[model samples]
Target: MTKAFASQGDLTEKKITFDEVGRDLWAFTAEGDPNSGVIIGDDSVMIVEAQATPRLAAKVIEKVREVTDKPISHVVLTHYHAVRVLGASAYGASQIVMSEAARAMVAERGQEDWDSEFQRFPRLFEGHESIPGLTWPTTTFNDRMTVYLGRRRVDIMRLGRAHTAGDAVIYVPDANVMFTGDIVEDHSACYCGDGHFHDWPGTLDRIRAFDLDAIAPGRGGALIGSDRVNGAIEATRDFVRSTYRPAARVALRGGTLREAWEAVRAECDPKFGDYAIYEHCLPFNVARAYDEALDIDTPRIWTAERDLAMWAALQG
Candidate 1:
């Protein structure tokens, strides 16, 4: 049997932090785990990112309780990813919100994605049995929408697609902070399994235009200063450019997937070797990049069976 570590392992839950950026804006981040954000309004609260499961989400809720007693009336999904939106039920939210494109992506491949991700990282789905079903958005906007948290304003915008076809950023203009769901990662590897390599840089440019002083990325710690925020965006962009572009070039040149993976490892490892999820992300990243380089608009589904088959083909 695979042994679990004493202090930590994939399944180990990390401590949650209630990072206060301003009076009412806060970030609930697990130690380098998937992070969530809390926005407290005059009379209500909104949760950004629902987490992987209800059990995992409760940890975030616990942090939220430490700051406010307002009922969580809105759950915003920056994008449709199993790890980010599956825990909506735990929030007991009045209305769950997502971009129109995100909702469409959920409808298109939500089930396949849930299966693929669970297969890739079984440890993250500790209490898989508790998941009620696919999370559906109660409300979805086409491009941009704004919400008022008492007198404070929160803007949810589907700026452009990068990490996913429907990537969104939650902007707290008052605090000059933004919650970039997978669009901006701080010291964490970009999971390009379902990403757009070519358009991702442009998306990062859109995020950089925010003039954000602070940012809570989809993974890693909260960036606290404007310089750090810019660093996060640049780092994330560099990962995409350095890792996937060469992989795409190799694939387009008729190089094998194994060859492409090797190219990426050699090129990226010297830089991002220690970043979280780099090893696990590379194979899928190469596969998706290969497809996109060939003009595949949508990423192909990754079933467990397909994952192994691809791994075996690349590994051999």
Candidate 2:
């Protein structure tokens, strides 16, 4: 029998873990579900990656309240995925920040992405009605922006493109911690449907250049200590390279998309098959890698129609 579309069959609720990764930084993870990072600055809080909906974000807020009462003053969208940004309203943050490229993506494909993701993963969109609308970034920057919550410094920088053309990381220089959005998933599959395969490794190198004591990745457990941080980075690099390289080679050799898909699965499944969302992400990841191998510089927008059609073709 055919597998359920994307994560539709994953209905069981995951156990949530709110652990302090650094002095004041917390990682809110849920058994490999989408994770969020909390930076409790001296004066206020900065939330990285809003949950899927306001109801979901409220759970994150409850965890934040357990630690401190400082208001969530800012919400940062590291990229423009619907699961990451649709919950922005719940935070009541004064400023919603994102990279300029991310802002453009919201304007261009936000609605389509919202529709696509809602269909793909119904469980994550539990409170779909609570979403005010497409989350908009009130503030945007091209390269980097610095915010000071009292004496602590939080740097939001768009190092390069990895998960998306606009991916950014929240760096805490003083604490030696980084909230790497989807750029570096610890044990989870990197959703590369909207990624830049060729540019991703370079982006990972840029992330490695930082002296990180801890990393709250987009998924999986928090990496605490420099050794764990480096390990996660290397694992992510290996995952990206292993998935893209073989698939790209197949496409460059005049192979069909199915051939490239099969090649990628043959190469990646043995190593990363058991990882979170590995099966759900494989088809899209291979599709993007195949296109990129043939020199498609930009990723095509994914709509609900496109999602179903692609899944049908690949899974057939």
lDDT (0-100) at residue 95 of candidate 2? 95
Q: Which segments of candidate 1 are over 4 A away from where they belong?
A: 1-9
lDDT of 1 by residue, 94-189 (tens): 899999999998889898888877876676676778999999999899999998877879899987878898988999887888888898887778
Candidate 2 minimal-lDDT segment of 10 residues: 307-316
Each model's lDDT comes to 0.83, 0.93
Enumerate clash totals for all models, in the order shown. Answer: 1, 0
Tens digits of per-residue lDDT for model 2, 95-214: 999999999999999999999999999999989999989999999999999988889899999999999999999999988899999999988999999999888989989888987889
Off by over 4 Å in 2: none
